[model samples]
Target: MKPADVIALPFQWGSELRHRKLFHPRGVLMSGRLERTAPEGEGLPLVSGPILGRVSKALGAPGRLPDIGGLAWRMETPEGSGKWDVLLASVMHGPLSRAVLRPILGWTGSEFSTLMPLAHDDELWWLRARITSTIDGGGLALTDIARRASGEGLDVTVEQALKLNEFQPLARLHFDGVVSGEDISFDPVVNEPEHVRLTPQWLTDFRRAAYRRSREGRDAPNRPTPEEAAEAKDS
Candidate 1:
C-alpha cells in the first residue's frame, strides 16, 4: 500500500467509529457569492460566482476551546465546465507561516489559508481569506458568524499571493444566507479547476488518500468528477 494510504488508516477507522468527520466534525453551511476583484495584470485566476461554504472548529471543540478554524468552499469554474473546491485552515498569513495551521479562539480575528501551494500556469500561488465584516458580538464562534450573516450578511476578502508576502485581492466573498443540515464534502484533491494542480505531488497523494478514507468511513458518496457530470448531462 502507498505510504499515505497507510498513514491514513487510523483516521479512517476513527471516522468510522465516530460516524463523523475526523477533522472539523461539526460545522455550519452558508450560501455566498464571490466577485472577482483582482486587477487585470495579476495572473490570478479570474473565476467568480455563487459559492457554498462552511465554517467550523477543526477539532469540533466546544465552548471556545482553542481549536483550528476551517473555512471550505465550492464554486464553479469561470467557463462553467467544472467545479473547484478550496479548503483553508486558520494560520499565519506570512509566506513561511502560512504553511502551518494555528489554533485560534475566534474566527473573525484569525486568517484562513490553504496550507499547500497551488500550481497554476506553471506558477505557485497561495489563497487566503479574512473576515472584513464586523459582527455585533466578538465573533468568537461559528454561531456568531452565522447570526451576523443571517442579518446584514458577512463580507470576506479573498486574496492570492505568488511566492511572497504581498497579496492582492482576488475576490470579495459575501455570505448572505445559512444552509441547514446540508451533507456536503469538499475534496480539493479531486475537485479542482482544469489545468490547475496542487503542488508537491507527494503531499497531494497524501491528501487524496486521507480524503478517500474519510469518505469511506462516513459512507459518503464522492462528488461527481467533471467527466461524470458531462456524461450525465449528455445522457
Candidate 2:
C-alpha cells in the first residue's frame, strides 16, 4: 500500500485548518461548541503567535505547502475495512477559501474519516527549525511529520513533529492525551510555548477544516453511518 496520499495529506499549498465534528457520541458535543478552547491547566505557558511560516496570500498556486512548523498527520484503515481514516493537522490561521475548503471536504470524506488529534496554535512552534545551507546550499528544512502507519491507537508527540517541521533539535516531546493513555518524554530543547491570539474566523475555519478532513474514511470506531451501510441496519 502507498505510505502517503499527497493530495489528502495536510499542508498542501494553501490549506486552511478546519475542525469537523465526529459523529461519535463523545464528539456530538463538539457541535454548537464555540471553541475547543486552548488547552489550559498545562501551567507550562501561554504561547503567542505570529504563526511561524504562514503563507501571506489567501490562496496560492498549486504546490504552495505551508511553511515548516505546520503538520497534517494521518492514518489509513486496513485493507477491506471500507471506513473513513483519521487526520491531524496544525493550522495558524491565514486564509480560508472555497478552493481550499471544497477539495478538503471531498477528499477527506473519501480517504480519512477520524480525527486523530487536534493541532492548535500553541503547537506550531514545534514545526519550526534552523538548518545549515548557505554557500553549502542555504535553505529552510521543514517537515510535516506523521506516523508511519495507522495503528489501533498511536500517540504522536510534539517533539518528533517539531523536529521534523522546524529542525528543533532531537530533544524529546512529551504530553498527555485524554484518551491516548500516552506519556511522551524525549530529549533536550523543548520548543517555546507561546499563545498568540488567532482570529475567531481562523479558528472557526480550522475546526471546520478539521471536521471535514476527519471524516476521510468510510468506517469509524463506532457504528457506520446510514449512508455507509445500506446493509448495516435491519440485518
Candidate 3:
C-alpha cells in the first residue's frame, strides 16, 4: 500500500502524554474542525478512530460545525507497546474534506516553498540558536540538547523533532492565523485567526517522494555483498 493511501484515512491529531505509559490523554481532529477530550486505552496510543468532530461528541463537546466526521486516528506509539501514555499529533493534512484531494495532489504550485515556522517558542529557538552557534564555532559538551528523551515542556510526541517518516504533530491546528503545522504557538492575540490550509499538490508530491524514498531506503540493504562491494571498488 502507498503512504498516500495509508495517509488517506480520516486524520486525527493530538498529544500522547507519558506520565507513565504511552497514552493520549488529549486528542483533537482537524478533519472536520473539531475537538475532543481523547479516548483512553482500548485503542491508544491512538492508531485510529472517528475524526475529532465525532470524538468531540463522544467527549461531550457541542458540535458548532455541522459536518459529521469519519474515522479519526493518529500514528501514536509513545510506549511502542504499553499503557498510560499520551499521543501528541494533529490531522493538519490528511484525506481531503470529501473527494477533493486528487487535483490538489496533481497540481504544481509554489505552496510547498512557503516556509512556515515549525517551532513556536521564540525564546527556545533563540537559546537553541545560541547553542547551535556555539556548536558551529567550536564548543562541545552540548548545552541546549536535552539530557533525556523527555524534558521540560517537551511533550515528546508532539513538539519533539521530526524524523524522516515520523512527525511530532500538534493536537490543535490553527488554520486562519498560522499557516504552519503548529497551533497558536506565537502571539495568539495578534496571530489574527488560527486556520490550516489544504495540502496542495506540492505537498502530495513531497509526501509521495518521501514515501518512495522511505520505502526504498527501508527495503534496500545498507551494505552490499562482498562481490558487489568488490565490483563497486573495481568500478
Error of 3 at 116 (Å): 7.3
Off by over 4 Å in 1: 220-235
Q: What lDDT score goes with residue 56 in model 1? A: 84
How displaced is residue 188 in candidate 3, in Å?
Answer: 25
Task: For residues 1-235, write the lDDT of model 3, one tens digit per residue.
Answer: 6555455322111111111111211223232121222343211122332221101111212223212111122222343332211111112232121122111111111011111222222211000000101112121111111121112211111121221222233233111111124211111112111121213445544544443433333344345656888999999
Model 1 steric clash pairs:
none
lDDT of 1: 0.83
- Give the TM-score (vs. native) of candidate 2: 0.20
TM-score of 1: 0.88
Candidate 2: C-alpha lDDT: 0.22
**lDDT (tens digit, per residue) of candidate 2 on 89-165:** 22322222101211121111111111121234444222211111111111211110111111121122222132123
Predicted candidate 1 versus true structure: per-residue lDDT over 1-235, tens digit per residue: 9899999887787777667799999887899998889875476564768999888888888755678989888999655888788999999656688888888866665799889988887888988898778755553567787887788998888889887667778988899999986759989999887777788999999999999998888885445666889999999
